[model samples]
Target: MECRFPSVPGAERILSDEALAFVAALHSRFGERRRALLAERDRRQARFDAGERPDFPTDHPGLSDPEWRIASVPDDLKDRRVEITGPAERKMMINAFNSGARVFMADIEDALSPTAENIIRAQINLYDAARRTISYRDPATGKDYALGDKIAVLKVRPRGWHLDEAHLVIDGERVAGAFVDFGLHAFHNAQALIDAGSGPYFYLPKLQHHEEARLWADVFAFTEEWLGLAPGTIKATVLIETLPGAFHAEAILYELRQNIVGLNCGRWDYIFSYIKTHRKDPGAVLPDRAAVTMTVPFMRAYALHVIKVCHRRGAHAIGGMAAQIPVKGDPAANEEAFAKVRADKEREAGDGHDGTWVAHPALVPVAKEVFDRLMPAPNQVDRQREDVVVTQADLLTPCDGPKTMAGVRMNVNVGIGYLAAWLSGRGAVPLHNLMEDAATAEISRTQLWQWRATGTRLDSGETVDAALIDAAFHAEVEALREALGEEAFAVGHYGAAADLMRELVQADELADFLTSVAYERHFAD
Candidate 1:
């Protein structure tokens, strides 16, 4: 096994011959299956676009089986009340581990820009973090950073099935990003993590069907046997982020029963999925992103159903990201943000969620306070949520809020801003006081496409058409340029980002994901 990929800093240390061999083995064994699954997704999506509505199957086999249960939740993963999520960047890696949260989700999927250096270096960070040797020193300030006595339990989130690792090729074919991430981390650190009182864990993303979950289960099984580990040593939490995935939550859990421990209400991606899945439905138009809070009817139904399904199968029901970063100097604004975070977590806790996620460390205490007060036990998996029932109507109900012109401007502004930041190798960006990532970007751009496709009407009595949307896009870009000034805008990939955002929003057809195109053309090495 000779490797031919481009190198990164400390690449040899992370990508040893044995590790590369392990990754290659996984690629060879599962690569074809992954390609088939992705193609299946396109086929299903095409059927959906041609007016086939998605609904729960009436002949859902064995749904009434009362005896099947998922594997037991490991101790380190049992209390995930405050899981802080971010990319596995070096400084962020050290900070997140010591952030005092119960669990830290080192995300390589939506929260990370999949640059070559980023993909390889992230594995190195996780390897070092697992060995308790993670540290970083700011070269400019000479500030030393190291892990603290108190640290969060680490869980890795691999890229979704839709993505591929262009930097890693095995047998003259590019490997799936999920395989590279999972194979490397599991190969290098699974046993060491188990030795240190934890186990290899993952949060699966963007699963559109139970078959995809089944694919992941098989991968876990194969990896464990190949690595000489126990069959169920690896546990996974599936993100019910798509409409089809939400409807098939029970089936998905069943497919991965032996290696499943939890289900997350991946709220942002769910919104994006709603738009993509229902783009052709004239009545499926969503309101402004601001108005589409978790309290909306569709969102509420999805959240409750996920909790119900997870608890029914003896697994944790984790809530989605709060995405609130505390304000520094403004006391009133900070108080309002804290109040919102507290309320969201309280709702999740009261509704039978075992744990929840926060994006920033500052909001950790707020989230922890809510869950701690509500959950005195390790988890609330015992709460079966028998009273909550979600019908297909409930999940598809549109909000009553109006889609306004201001909403159009906001989407273009934030969408372009996030794209610039993403193209510059930053995935998690703070814009207009909100922490945004690929999920938000996905929603921003997809919503624009959806509105245009459906001829959505704004509150100002204007229908969404190409001319109106195009003008909004250009106006927003010029405003952003002025706001960022010549120097700051010129320093990054803002020019390319503006063009890409405009092309995506103004095109006749919607792209599956903006990053899929952006990564291939701009970031992939």
Candidate 2:
């Protein structure tokens, strides 16, 4: 109903009267319930703080029907052997669609820093992308870019329900960011995609509970009704990335059964959630971020169980990300990165995952090669993992490894670097040859907080306290300054990022998400 900054040019096209009306209708209908669900998160968190552990819903009716299955998926969505994810920036969009993957998920969430300009720009690109009219040229290099005849299927990821778009005010309240991203695109591009023999496809991120999934289902149903489309026109794959959300996989699939197609194992955020959900439990302190691989007891259990539950319910069980980016001009380093990605993708393929994600375009073929060689079919949904049985305790199994000073240094360095880039208008950034997004940075921040709060003892007998944290931060900052010259470091947002990181890691309680605090403090319209 209102714009926070009306003077921002190009706002008119995205915020046209009809678009605003649709978004406002969505907000007016579901805004209060969205707020209630968010409050439910705090309530559930309070229980976790009070020593109540999360468990699967025992009374869910959907589990009673062993024959129940989600509606059949679209033909294009089947055979998603390799999927690529990136922010909806112009160049990234063009490249990702042409990345030779089955699906290119244009993420407007963690992979994107939610600036007003960025959100509007993403929506505009999605409009063009749906119609295959998207194009670009290198202003500096004089090179041209356009969509090829064959491109990866476009699936958009809107911001999670926990976020709001400060730039778009509707009915005197800041509209949900999810509504803006989903509403604008679905409003503008759904019919075009339908006409093209495709429909509005989406990847829902950061759902901590099945109720959240239920809310999304309601949103999708309402959108279809609003747009005069058939039921189940919108298809989504939920990312079972949170510790709590993983426990409710059956219920989540049940809630979105009408429009649901698959479930993805999100590694980074699930680890982060494991730390945050158990932040108050001293025994749950994890090891170095790198040490906690998908093979860990809990992660392994969840990954296998996802395959079991998804296949049982006739949905595709997508695997986690291969975040390793290819390095140029250094054959050895590039080989090492390639090896890591290959191993990860192979494990996913062998474990009966339908597909896996790659952060960069170059790694698409690398992932595809693994799936293509091993799978030899469109999908393996028939491989019911009945032999794989994971229990409540198994899903919550504690990680085991050594906590060291090196781990602390890496966390501090990566956290600051990511925050600096996120504040500088980039959501997905390259750090140490890997693509770092909000989810990865979350692992850094939450791990640091858990260590400090529990006074974790490092390999060198050093206790994780405020002093040790400050020391690590300072050491990493100086190292970064030398690595990236003083002039560049001084001009960047590293200073503000440092100040914010200190406040976050030093807080008495762990924050839910670093982006939440950062967006409100700095990037808010």
Candidate 3:
């Protein structure tokens, strides 16, 4: 198999001939299947646009079987009380590894800016992280950083199936992004992790069907065999981040049952999925992003449903992300932020979730404190949520509240601000005291587009239309420019972001992924 990619700094060490072989092999076996599944996603979207609401999935064979369970996870994975997540950048990885959380999810998907450089950096950084040799020294401060004696368990999240890796072209085409992320790490570091008593653990993202789970299962099976590892050596937790995914929660677990360890409530993307899935429907227009809390009826149902399905299948039910960051110098605001985090973690722990995710390391102890008090056990997998009975209506219910000018402005500013940073090679940016990633960025842009498409009337009685979108868009651009200052704003990717934002909000149809558009327009180098 032939491979072509830019020779970045760590290219030689990370993408050795053997590793390239593994990548090519996986792509050869599963590349066509990946495209087919993505197409299926489009077909499903068309069905929804044609007025068919998402229904509860009950077609899989294992949904009715009560005795079956997911395969047992390795020892280190058992007690994921709190997990800290960030991009696989050096210092961030070290901090997350030493955050005292039970697990650290080094995210190469939503949490990473997948420029060719960042992609190569992540692979090298993760390889070093797996071997416990990653370190960094700040050029400005000269402060050296390394892993702690007692580090968190390592997990990696690859990009979704819908993405393609432009940097690495195989057979005259871009390989599936997920394959490169999962393959390079697994090829170079899987054995090392296993030799150190931990397997190649992963968090699968953006799955919308059980068959996608099945494809991943096959990939896992093949990797284990090719690497001469035992069956079930590769354990994964699927993120129920899509509306269709929440509907088929049980079936998805069953598809990957032999090698799967759990399911996660990816709340941010799930919200985006809800809007995207129902983009053409006026009735599903959501209100302010702040108004859509986890306790809302539909989100609550989805979270509880994930817990129920995972626990019943004897798998861990990981909770959603606490994206709040501690604001410096504003004690009152910080207290309010911590209070929100406390309440959110309490809800998850009290609801029988085994663990949860926190964005910043400061919030790690905050979340761990909640879970430590609520869940004494390492995991709550044994606690079957029997009373969790979710229906189509409960799962499909959108939040009812005000869609205000405030909401529109927020959507526009965040859309441009986050995208500007993202195009400059930063995936996770703290805006307004909260960590913003691709998932949250998706929410920002999609909400604007959805509101615009639906002509959603705000509580202020202004109907969302072309004029309103333009007003909000231009205002947010200028506001971001002023707020960020002249020099900073000039170098920012605001122009490109605004261009994409305009395309998205004014399009006759909603775009699927905001990152995809930005990836093409800005990452053409």
In order of appearance, the predictions have TM-scores of 0.98, 0.98, 0.98
Query: Candidate 1, which ten residues in sequence have the lowest lDDT sum?
Result: 57-66
Where is the poorest 10-residue window by lDDT in model 2?
2-11
- The pairs that clash in candidate 2 are none
**lDDT (tens digit, per residue) of candidate 2 on 1-525:** 667644444566777889889999999999999999999999999999899999989888667778889998999999999999999988889999998999999999999988878888888889889999988898999888999889999999999999988987865789999998999999999999999989999999889888899999999999999999999999999999999999899999999999999999999999999999999888888899989999899899999989999999999999999888889899999999999999999999999999999999999989999999999999999998899989999988798898999899989988999999999889999998999899888999999998999889998999999999999898888888888898888777887888899889999978888999999998784
All candidates in order of lDDT, best leading: 2, 3, 1
Instruction: Give one digit per residue, the lDDT tens place, for model 3 in 285-336.
Output: 8889989999889999999999999988889999999999999999999999
Model 1 agreement with the true structure over 1-525: per-residue lDDT tens digits: 435455876789888888888888888888899999889888888998898877775555525676788977898888888899999988987888888899989999988988888888899899998899999999999999999998999899999988988877766788888988999999999999999999999989999888898899999999999899999999999999999889899888988999999899999999999989988888788999899999999999999999998988898999989988878899999899889999999999999999999988888889999988999898888888899989998988788797999998888888888888888889999977678899888898988888888888898999999899889987887786887898888887777887898799888788999999999898665
Cand. 1 Cα-lDDT: 0.88
* Candidate 3 to truth, TM: 0.98
lDDT of 1 at 449: 87
C-alpha RMSD in Å of predicted model 2 compared with the true structure: 1.1
Best candidate according to lDDT: 2
* Global lDDT of each candidate: 0.88, 0.91, 0.90
Q: How big is the positional error of residue 466 in model 1, measured in Å on the Cα after superposition?
A: 1.1
